[model samples]
Target: MGQIDGWEINCDMGEGFGRWKMGPDEELMKHVDVANVACGFHAGDPSTMVRTVRLAKQHGIRVGAHPGMPDLLGFGRRRMAIAPEDMYAAVLYQVGALSGILAAEGMPLNHVKPHGELYFFVQRDAAIRDAVLRAVRTFNVPIYGLPTPQMVADCERVGVELIPEFYTDIDYDSRGALVPVAESVPVSPQMIRDRILMIAITGQARSATGTTVDIPLGMGGFSICIHSDLPGALENAKAARAAVNEVKKGIRISIY
Candidate 1:
């Protein structure tokens, strides 16, 4: 809850709508430690949310709320100008929905993570970030997010724990910005495993321009993220899990 030791693998799940689905969530659940569950705004319906939480419980994994903008048609990827009040309401609405679902399943809502464009919006806008943090404070749970300078400060200001995350299947650009994960392109599991080791051992990574970016693994730990929608996602998750285990035994595999 407050501060945990070591790293954990978290994957987005239950991103399906009704009978339609996006990723192999059932199989993917076996490889990750936590599930960022959709709360009906981006991709999940009420029934889908229940099924997703049950899947996490089946795997004996933790559950968290993944709140996104009200852009279901765009899958919550489209950016929008939202008022701070609106952001607060949307976060609480979605998080509360999933919290109730977790209650029925007898599992506590472990954390809150903004989805898609909302994730960036909170990072770039202080007002919206404050709004979202206020809503999260109600549940008194940690947040899975990037540890931007302002974000780290704000989490401390609000008395909430911030679990910084790094991506195993995504890359950074020359400017140190994350190159978005392309769902259609296939990334080799070997490459993904190398990335996991590279960052886990050094706490840093090289961007496309060869810029060294420091990843904030606070308290000597991190929450590693692997997207479920990427091609060869299950293999990637397995590779990442294996690489994490290797790191646990004081083994450092460098991609250099």
Candidate 2:
């Protein structure tokens, strides 16, 4: 087994709008280091944002913005063709709203991680990537996602912090990058635990095709992500925490 000196767990929270709620935010918060609060675009309302921010504060976790395409019907998972200008504006507006919520709660906005389709779109489209990166730079907060070569270069050129992330609750491809989920399936706590151990300790993951993929976790500059909307989110978080703690060997794990 490989060794990890330090790591942090992050989760998406506050994804409900109006009367509808999603995920066990409270329980998951206890096991994570950051909360990616959904803005009003994809999911979450003004009140939900504030409440989620408050919850993050209470749990002593950092708060980040989870901006998505305004596709609430599809939970922001559906890809939408968006103009560069519009994408920039949407990201800016959503991030600003969440920043306001954090400011009101006397908390700082730690990062900006795009949610759902918007997240993947930025990686593949240069125009959208530039727009989104430009918008994120305005806030001067780190951006969280996969550590692609282009992403690294863009973030460096734009002068924004880049925190490469690994998705433990989802499957990866031969490249060790997450493959989009087609359904909300429950990932068992044991499965999650095994995945975290492999990622944090070895800096490697098994892909869907049974290929072993390499990640940069061993190089430090990486983080773990757990999808709150996924089935068994709370259990997954617990399992991850336990696995990290075991690796830590009584030493405190620092949340970057």
Candidate 3:
């Protein structure tokens, strides 16, 4: 296999607030290529956000904003029905906050990847997607999203770059939607490696319902996301990267 095929290992970091901390961000950072620093809405305060961005830069990893709804209690994973304008404002607030921090640190945001429920919502809801698109349009950064044709079309309509991202730590349904992580889906390191290999080799995935769904892999443009909050996330990411490397040596896997 040629090293031209590259994968990006990204993680959600800086999700702590006040005195409460979440996950081993520093340890996880050593294994990931990109760090999606959470804006204050869902989790993280100004101090945390700034620190996370600085740390990512020090580690030579690409930094991006991990925007979410204003649902701190649910950790921004609970679905919230809101107007398009509100959605746009919320995204702008989050992304702008991170962008400022990045600018102050002399680092630029490489992309934007919505967190938790907001991610799934935008994937299926055109109105919500448009809101996010509008907010991100003000900035010159790529939008990381699901690799669906509709999403690509939406990005094109907004004249923004779209980096279709896939998750190696999550399951997909027959319809190609992410199987909610709350559904107790079994995800192990081996299974994750298998899924990545399947996508890299076949450009598709066998869904939980035993149906083969077309995935936009090997299309010369796509990215992979591995969440840091999941159990054994670091190990799984290392394994996935090792597998990708074994199949194709000297390939540079970017984190953002």
The residue pairs in collision within model 1 are: none
Off by over 4 Å in 2: 1-5, 183-186, 250-256
- The per-model lDDT (C-alpha) reads 0.84, 0.84, 0.80
lDDT of 3 by residue, 34-60 (tens): 888999888999999988988898898
Tell me which of candidates 2 and 3 scores higher on TM-score.
2
Q: What lDDT score goes with residue 207 in model 2?
A: 83
lDDT against true structure, model 3: 0.80
CA shift of 189, model 3, Å: 1.4
lDDT of 2 by residue, 1-256 (tens): 1111247888999998898999999889889888899999889999999989998898888888999999989999898889999999999999999988888889888899999889899889989999999999999888987888888888898888788888888788887666887732347888787887776555788788878898764366567888898878898899888877876674433321
Q: Residue 159 error for model 1, in Å?
A: 1.8
lDDT of 1: 0.84
State the displacement of the C-alpha of residue 244, model 1, in Å, after optimal TM-score superposition: 0.5
Steric clash count of candidate 2:
0
Where does candidate 2 clash, by residue pair? none
Rank list by TM-score: 1, 2, 3
**What TM-score does prediction 3 earn?**
0.91
